[model samples]
Structure formats: structure tokens, C-alpha cells
Target: MDYSKDKLSSFLEVNYSALPMCCIQKAEVYMLDEPSSYLDVKQRLRAASLIRDMISSTTYVIVVEHDLAVLDYSSDFICCLYGVPGVYGVVTLPSGVREGFNMFLDGFIRTENMRFREDKLSFKVSEQIDEVVKRTGNFKYPSMTKTLYHSNSTMLAGFLKPDEEVEMPATTVSYKPQKISPKYESIVRHMLHEKIPNMYTYPHFKSDVMNPLMIDQLMDRKVQTLSGGELQRVALVLCLGKTASVYLVDEPSTYLVSEQRLHAAKVIKRFIMHAKKTAFVVEHDFIMATYLADRVIVFDGEPSVEATARRLL
Candidate 1:
């Protein structure tokens, strides 16, 4: 195989790079930093298995991950890192996976008896979840079966509850896939101009979403030069700028920090409400998911193997 001639996809690039470390030239201790960054749900599951397989009596693996789902699946013992950014930092003693996550979310460390922040972050429950549900239309639903036939395989997705349907009808969609062109080189200002509803077009969105995302600050910079987080913000604005009946946004929280995630969620929610548009988002961040989802469609079963989608109310 000519490595130089063949252009590998992002998934292949990630797996191929890690293959050398785990398969060919083995190292005593393997370190993976955010291996799930650009991967989809199925890919993250496969990666978790791959990372787990690298562990043995003689070999050790250490991973730094932000996606709680991937972190939970990939880790045995969990360590929490806390501190002011770009300053002194502290690492907590390894704890059980659940405990570590709780500590992080609660902003309180039980073992250390430390409180990092005054407030606790948690998923929205009964009342809070209800407030986010918007009524876009009144539609009828009945138990119906539709099969899409292909030569190789069949796929199914349950979009509504068994008793209900037509809540969200099929329509024209604006989809933002997980993979983006990392090599696209153009000034941010020029790049954004190429998208629909340029910066000059929507003054309100400029203040509401773009400003919070720091897009104004990045206007002079080049797309290829922007950091991952910056690029994500840019991509989001571009996706939202387009007019569509249904917006399919994949992994909007990728490369964003906690604050950025929340901000992005707000932007999406506000856009949906103001434009009277529907958005179907694929996200691993529970906070973002809780904030954006009115109803959930869960994909169950094995990743990259077989799965079933069931509607969760």
C-alpha cells in the first residue's frame, strides 16, 4: 500500500495512527489524548473497545478524555483533574467511575473534602425538561411499519413512540456531518461570507450567538489556523446560518468546553424557537443533550455491529 498516494478518511487516520502503537511497536505505557474527538457514536464505542484491548498484565494504558460516555466505557479507575486553566492544577486520587463523574458534576470531591465551585451541575428533571418541550404542530401517529430494502443490509430507526407519530414529519434538512474539512484554508471573514446569511445579514444573531462564540475575534484569522474549538464555533454558525425546515447537527459539543457547550446549546435552542424550525442533534454530552432534546430516540445494541432505535419519552 502506498501511504503517500492513498487518502485516508479521518476514522482511518485515527485508527491507523494508533495501530502502530498498539499492534506493531508496543510501548510499556500507552497514552491516548482525546481519541474520540472527531468520531461518531459508533466509532467512539469501537475506540473504547480498542483502548481496552490494549491493556494487559505487561502493558498499561492512560487516556485523557472529556466525553463522559467514552470515558465511562474506556476506564476502570478514574481520576479527576481540577484547577484554574493555564495555572496550577490538582489530580484527585483514583475513584470509581461513577463517583468520579459525580464529583466532577457536583463540583465537590468527597474523598478530598474539597469544593471547587459553589453550584452543582445536573441533568434537568421533570419540571425543567417540560419547559423545553415546544409544540410545533399537531399531528396524528399510528403504529406503522416501513422497511427500506438494500442489497447488503437493512436499517431501521424508530422516530416516534409506538402509540404516536407525525409529531415531526419528514422535510428538507440542513445536515452538518461529524467530519469537516480540516484543511480548508481561507480567512474566517471570507469563509463566513461564503455561507448563507453572512455576518452583515443578521445583526441580532451576530450579538446573540456569534459574539458569545467569539466569532468576531476570529474574523481576521484563517480557517486552517484556528484551534479546534474555534473551528467548531465557526462550523456551528455556518450550519445555523443556512435556512432549512430540519437541521441535523452532529456533535455540536465536540472540541468545546463546558461553558462553550452551554452557549452553543442556547444558540441552537434559540434559533429553533425563533425560526420555528426543528433540529435533530447527535450529541454525547449529557448536559447539552438534556438541554436540547425534547424527545429522545435511543440507538440500542452493539456499535458497528447491529442496533435498534427506540423512542424514549
Candidate 2:
């Protein structure tokens, strides 16, 4: 629960004394500096840190944001609150947690009345457990209920409730854009000095700006301005420019628009196919997967690897 600066202040004014002081340690309560504007990237980074803290700490942390009502009780269920696009549900899992915990997620898909059979170590739903098993493929370990919700009723039913649609405020600003520093410039210059001619130098070369050439120039000009896509592009350049034997990219196309995403795919394909380097990319884009990969590993029901040459024909 990462609260914006304004929301935190208001919350403190209203419930500072009322809040359980015994629970929250003085060192744990961090009030970040107010961002310059909503577009500040540092704010997201700061919020990420706070989120990490909350997840790691034993204390129950509550984050208050503008446009959100302060609940009386702490919620066990995590709600996204913000209606970020392409998300299936509000309380799926936090990013950091997902990255760490996804490996342990054997039977944790969305479901209700699910039971774990330790003898066979399989997941079983009351009604359609068998069907789900067929669809997901048989599991080696017992399937545990993905969602753990409590009901006051006598029957303890484990069901996944539809997430409430939360309308985020029009201007619940999260980040403020940062100014490029000398360190950013030096990084870009070092990249340009790599002697890659096709790598077009941009204006603001810093990872923050949208335009590629401008981003490079900005890196030189000490002006850091960029969107998410631009930052990914800059990162891609830096990664490819290096002389690594094995390159691994994990979902590089996240938070990108259609055209830019396609362009990024093309760039990645070009790099992997033509460049004298070995690269492994984990991407959801089917087209890019088919085009770029010599041997495609499809993890649908079971992980299957096939040669692209055989599959195409």
C-alpha cells in the first residue's frame, strides 16, 4: 500500500493518533518527498521501495492515496485499487511478490472449493476439478486453493469473487519526471562509443525520454525525459551493445503500445538473428516467438520445444 504524498499527509492529520502506534515502528513509517509533478519516474521507484518494505516487514502497513477511502480495518486481501489496464484482477499479486513466488505457484490459479490431495498431490475442485485438471494438465503436487477468502456462513466455501471495479481518480499522480544528470550522459556516451553505427543516437540518451535519438541527446544534454517504452528501448540498446555470451530478456515488451511493440519485436529479432551473440527471450507475443526463435519452447499445458524449421513447413 503506497500512498501519495498528499494522501499520506491528510491521513496522518485525520488518524495519526487513532492508528495503532504499537504496530507501526517509527523507523518503518516513511514519508517520501513530494514529487515535482505526476510524471516523475522516481516516485514509482520510491513507491516500489515502500511496497517492498511493506511486504517484507512483519508490521501491517496501510497506504492511503487520494480518492481512496480509509478503511477502519486492515484488509488481508490485497486490492490493486488502481484500474491499471490489461490486468485480470485487482488482488492477483504484487509485482515483486509475483517475480519471487511464481515458481512456487503449482496449483495457484483462480478457483473456489478447491482441495489439495496430498496422496496424489493433485488439485481438486468440488464440481469441475477433473475438467480443470484436464485443461491444466496433471499436477505432480497437491493443488491448493489459489484464493483464501473467509465467509461468515456455516459452509466454508473457497471461491474467487470478482474484483470490485475501482475507478481511479483522473489525476492520482504517481511519478514526477527527473532531470538528466552527468552520470546519465556518461552512460549514453559509453554506449555510443561501442561503435555500433546502426544504433542511432537520440536527443536525450537517458532512459527516461520517448524518442530514441532525443533520448541519446538528452543523455548528453543532461536532460532525462522518457516514457516506459523509451526506457525499455534505452535498456535494449545498452544490453545489446554489450558483448555478453548469453543474453536473456524477460518480457521486454511490457507497457508498450502496438506499433512501438512491433518495432521493438523487429529490433529484438534483428539483434538475435543477425548479431553474433546468443540470446534467449521470454515473450508472450506469438508472432515474435515464431519469427525470432530457432527452437520454440511452448509452455501451454506442458512445456514443449520444437524446431521452427520443422513447425513452419
Candidate 3:
């Protein structure tokens, strides 16, 4: 099924607020029985009840809020609460663990916890948590405390070091364009249908310098040459000509109206899916990115691109 259809199916099946409150509380696990079709209120309630039941059966329940943009301490705590085996070591303190659950709600804590796990295989929230536990007199519960170490010098030293240069392998890095095979020609033709001015004559001008009707009109004596947006579209068409395992495009919506930009994005995505080639596009427009990309990346001035890619995925 198409992306929109899949998303709508999921949305309908998991729409908790739409379902009856009682059903949501009693359900175990929800599955998309017929993902291709739309679901009514009754179907949604049944799905929610199944999911609720599954969650209730487990010792530790984790509820991930859909609107949560960042996973924080609460998310990590929930994950750890569920992930660890045996109920003996795990502790669920009284509701008054902190002054408010705000500290545990920020995603930064979750990110830091992940970093701690990667570096030390253990995560300890601040000593304040222990203080809070003592204040509330929940000390009888077996609690797990994690200690995090902070070293300014070590952090600065890593930042000061020069970034390692990536060397392109000699065999794969070539300056010349590889010839397009006849089998791949069909894919190219299909992609060109939307970008090309006249679909009828696209086959005749695949490799020729002859511009499309729009390009010709722009270059006419009465009108000025093509604008930046027009040039970018031409650049995009040229980029698609190369043969590669993956295509990395950065911000194709530089100068275009909303509708036009969306149209361009759809065309590019179709090409990628049709060719069965991986496409990595970096975009700041959230709406367009959500519609066009399979995954999104949010950069935070970090040295590693993988860090951002992981969060997006």
C-alpha cells in the first residue's frame, strides 16, 4: 500500500482518543487486521483494548506519548523499567519521586542516559533522585542509582582534535559519467514525465541539449533567462543522470512556491522508489520532509552525522 494509506490505517487503528475510554483501559495489543481499509469507532476501540491488555500483562508498563518530540529521563526510566529482567531489582518509587516530573520529562535526560549506556553500560540519574527518594521516605524499595561523570578537559580535547578526512576509494571515485543502460532508460523516462515540459517528445530529447518548452519560453527574446528556481530544477534533472547506489540531495526547495516544491519532492521520491535506490535528503521544511522522506535528520552541530540520523529514525 501507499505511504498515506499505511499512515492513515495506523492512525485510525491507534487513535486512542477516538475509542471508548473503557476499551482503551482493558485492551492488550492492537494490530492492523486490514490495513488497506479505514476503521470505524468500534474497530478502533477493539484495537485499543487489545493493546491495553498486552501492556497491562507486563510487570512494567511504558507509555510513549505520540506528541513527545524528545525522549527524556521519563522515557529512559520507562524503557529500563520494562527492559530489565526480573522484578526483584527493579523499583517503582512512590509518585512523589521528584518535586515535579518535569526533570524526567525533558528529552535531554534520555539522550544523556543513552550516551551513558554507550560509554559506561550503566546510567545513573543525578544524586538528587536519591535525595528525593529519601525525602519521600520510599527508601525501603530496592532502587537503582546511576552516576554520571563529567570531564571538561576530555570533552574539550575531543572537540579540539581535527576531523579525519574521508578518502574516496580509487575504483569507485570517477570523474566521468557512466553510460546509462537501455534497461535503466525506462526508469529515467518515467521520472522525466513530470519534470519535462511536454511528455510527448521526452523520449526524443533524452540526451540532447534541446531545452524543454518552459525552458525555451524563458529564454525567448521577450523574456529574461531562467531564474534560480528554474536552474535548480535543471540541476536536479542533471544529478539524476548519474549512476550510483544512493543519491544524497540537500534542500531542493530552495526557491519555489509551496505547491511547486511539493510536486518536485513527489517526483524525486517516485524516482528513488521506482529505481529501488536509497535517497538521503536533508531538509529543514518539516511538512515537506515528513511527506517526502522515509527518515528525517535533525542536526545539532555535532561532529557525527550518525548521531542525528539515529534520532530521526
Candidate 4:
């Protein structure tokens, strides 16, 4: 138990001290149901590690975890289960780790020729994760004397780019707009050198943000002369270029076409997870928000007025 706790500490994002309490006897077979439940991405990995630590050739450890990343990292073999809840369940014979994960995601049993789901689900995590662990994290919010309006407003996120003019939402005005560039690459270069000097290299940024948002095709276009959709894409590229603990974005889908709106949601979701950062967004697009958010805070009162913040978990 002591070894388990110590080995898990490196991957644990949250403090967990219940390892000893959860187990009283040493058994040949141990089972845990959704141990990754209630844990963030980092903690989930640690939980997976702890479960793996419980295994010996003589002992079999089974973890019923829903998180694909945790499951993939934790198990050497898997039993994919398909069934109607509380009625009947079909569990396949154990398969090698990668093969089991591929089958689970594909939602098919090749041996039985069974298709549990009509649609296949696919997703990827990229290289943006390297920087998340390097930073210290704890949100420090402001304390103010006067009441502040909730409707779209601007704030100097005191930590990012020193005094860089951030044109917030709900405002028709622009502050400190930089020189228009005929080539989009110039704008990115200027922003990189002037603002986040140590930002990930251009190639890395392109892999994490540009390719998904399709910013590369606009590389030669002038910033001021770009169309609404193109400009939105540029803005997204710039916003996601820098690294931070908390990202505040307002109405990201503005001026974007239908397809671009969906792509923007994907960009936000991928960046948040890969970077392991928190994001607060002010968006009127309900569909986009629901698709991107894991937990959403609902305004339980009048719009642009008094409202209680309720979380839909």
C-alpha cells in the first residue's frame, strides 16, 4: 500500500490518500469499478498506474474504467463488454491491449461479427501535453469593491502578455490593433516575438492549432483584407499560440461559417485537454458549447441580469 501510494504520486494531479482504506485483505482477484471516475486527466492516469501496480502474474487485477486513455494505459489485456443494462451482458475473451482498445473504440466484435454501435467514434491527443506539467497552476481571481456587470466585458488577465491590448467581447471598438499584414505568417511572427517569446515553435503550433483550424491555407493572405471566416481563423490561431494556465475566450464562433464553427469547437476542446488548462468562454452558441464542454455552468436567471451559476455535471 505504501509503495502504491508513493509510485502514484508523480502522475496524480489531485491529492489522494485512500489507497490503504479501500483495501483490507490481500486477495488473488481484485476488482475496481470506474476508479478513474471523479478524477481529472492527470489523476486518471495515476489511478491507472495504481491499478497496474496491484497486478502480479499470480494475481489478476480488473478495473472497470470508462476513460479510454486510462484503460489503454492501465491494462495489458481487455475484455470488451456489450449488453443491455440490468438485463444481459456479453464479455469477450481477453485481448492484447492495443487490439482491445481499437475494438472498443471501433465498437465491433470481429470474432462474433457483432456491431454494438451504428457509428464509429474516433479522436486523437497530440503533442501539446509536454508543456502542461512544467507550469504551476492555481487560479487567482480578483477582489473588487464595486459590482461588475456579467454581460460581455474586458479584463486584463494580469498574467499574460504584458499590457497587450485585449479587445474583449460585447464591444464594437478595437484597441491597439497592429499593422495589417499582407502575409498571415508575418502577423504570427510579430506576435510570437513581441508577446510570447518562448511559445512553442511554429511547427508545433501548426500541429496543435493551425492544421485543425485550417490556418495554413491562409498563410499568404493579408490580415486586414481577409474575409470574416478567414479572420476568425487567424484570431483563433493567435489565441491558441501562447501557453497559459487559464484561457478566457469570448464568442469564438463569431463571423465563422457553419463548418468553421464546428471546427472551432474541436480546436478549443483539443487545446484545453492537451495543454491541461481551464477555459472560460462567453458564447451564445448553445450547440457549440455543449459539444465542447465536459461540464457547463448554466445561467439560471434572466439574460444580462441576475443569475445563479449552476453546473450541469
Query: What are the RMSDs of all candidates, in order?
Result: 7.5, 22.3, 24.8, 18.4
- lDDT of model 4 at position 260: 56
Which runs in model 3 stand beyond 4 Å of their true positions? 1-162, 165-224, 302-312
- Candidates by lDDT, descending order: 1, 4, 3, 2
lDDT (Cα, tens digit) per residue for candidate 2, span 173-246: 11111111223434444445553433444322222223422343334522144455455555566555544455
lDDT of 3 at 299: 39
Every candidate's lDDT:
0.68, 0.35, 0.36, 0.56
Best by lDDT: 1
In model 4, where do residues sit more than 4 Å from their true spots? Answer: 1-193, 196-200, 300-307
Give the per-residue lDDT digits (tens) of candidate 4, residues 1-313.
Answer: 3355445432111134454244435898887765643343344566677877788888887777555556678889988887643368888989998888777768788877888866565443343545334334432222221212122223434322212243333322221111113343354445445654554356666687778777656655446567655666666666676655556675675555434566688888888787767676655444455566665455444322233444333
Q: Which model, 3 or 4, shows the larger TM-score? A: 4
**Candidate 1's residue-wise lDDT over 1-313, tens digit each?**
3444245534435554554455455689888877776554666787888888888999888888877777899899898887754357888999999998888889898877889977776554335555555465443333233311110011112232332333444466676656567566778887777776454358887877788687877889888987777888888988788777877787888777665677788788888878888777877676578777877766555433334455445
TM-score of each predicted structure versus truth: 0.63, 0.31, 0.33, 0.42
Worst 10 residues of 2 by lDDT: 148-157
Candidate 4 local Cα displacement, residue 124, angstroms: 12
